[model samples]
Target: MTTAFSLAPLFRSSVGFDRFNDLFESAARNDSASGYPPYNVEKLAEDKYRIVIAVAGFQEQELDLQVEKGVLTVAGGKRDNGAQNQEKDNVTYLHQGIAERAFKLSFRLADHIEVRNAGLANGLLTIDLLRQIPEEAKAKRIPINGQQVLEREGS
Candidate 1:
């Protein structure tokens, strides 16, 4: 009989990850296209964030943005030509890089984080991110006095 290989180690490590691992593992399955729709995540102000996506070929009517169970999903299908093909000039090869493709991009959101605003301007689609500070997570200092407080044992 041949020696047995250990798949046990893999399961043991995974158990330690718990919820964190679940989120991590789920992301890997569909994270092959993080750069799709060409977006940017930035902290606009002290407590504000912004996500901007470049959607040159997608129209406002053709795009969909939804928030479900703490996930922000942005999906779009190509609009009908929109006179772009009529102006398609396959001439001098300076650099032709912009893709005329239809794609969908998703972002995993944390608790209290919300999509504040979204707009498409010029050829760029901007999605603003705002985090609603929860009462427990917000900054609050505890007053401490240098004195021995009474302690109660479990009843």
Candidate 2:
């Protein structure tokens, strides 16, 4: 059984968090899916991050990456080719270990965070991220102007 959480109170008190609510709802809805092809998220630097996912049976040609509306999506899998179909038909497995199913994973990005690069090696898919704050968005010091007052009018 799953418990439902209401964000009504949080919405009443918070501002500019409309998207967060949607993310929460989507996560809750998709919680039933199995966590196949495990992944790891690592922080390489203060403003840099990397996500590595295990995709042992997937090839570069079978993988896809997309970014849209502050969301990054990674998908892996392809329709069975002739060789794969023949292998499946002829081979009998005593135990199946590796997962060769299609999967799609999505990640929400914060403002100014962008995908820098992606690479696949040794059955691991690595996605790099960088946070670039614009000059106008960064904090700046304001200079205060000083003026001298004259007392001649009072005299």
The C-alpha RMSD in Å for every predicted model, in order, reads 8.9, 7.1
Scored by TM-score, the top model is 2
Per-model TM against the reference: 0.64, 0.74
Candidate 1 has an lDDT of 0.67
CA lDDT of each candidate? 0.67, 0.75
lDDT of 2 by residue, 1-155 (tens): 99997754333211122477665566456543326667776678878878888999788999999989887888888667898788888988999899788988776677788899999999999999988989999999977658655457767
Worst 10 residues of 1 by lDDT: 9-18
lDDT of 1 by residue, 36-153 (tens): 6666666677567777788886779878899888777888886566466555643565776866576777666766777888998998888887777789888899789998676778
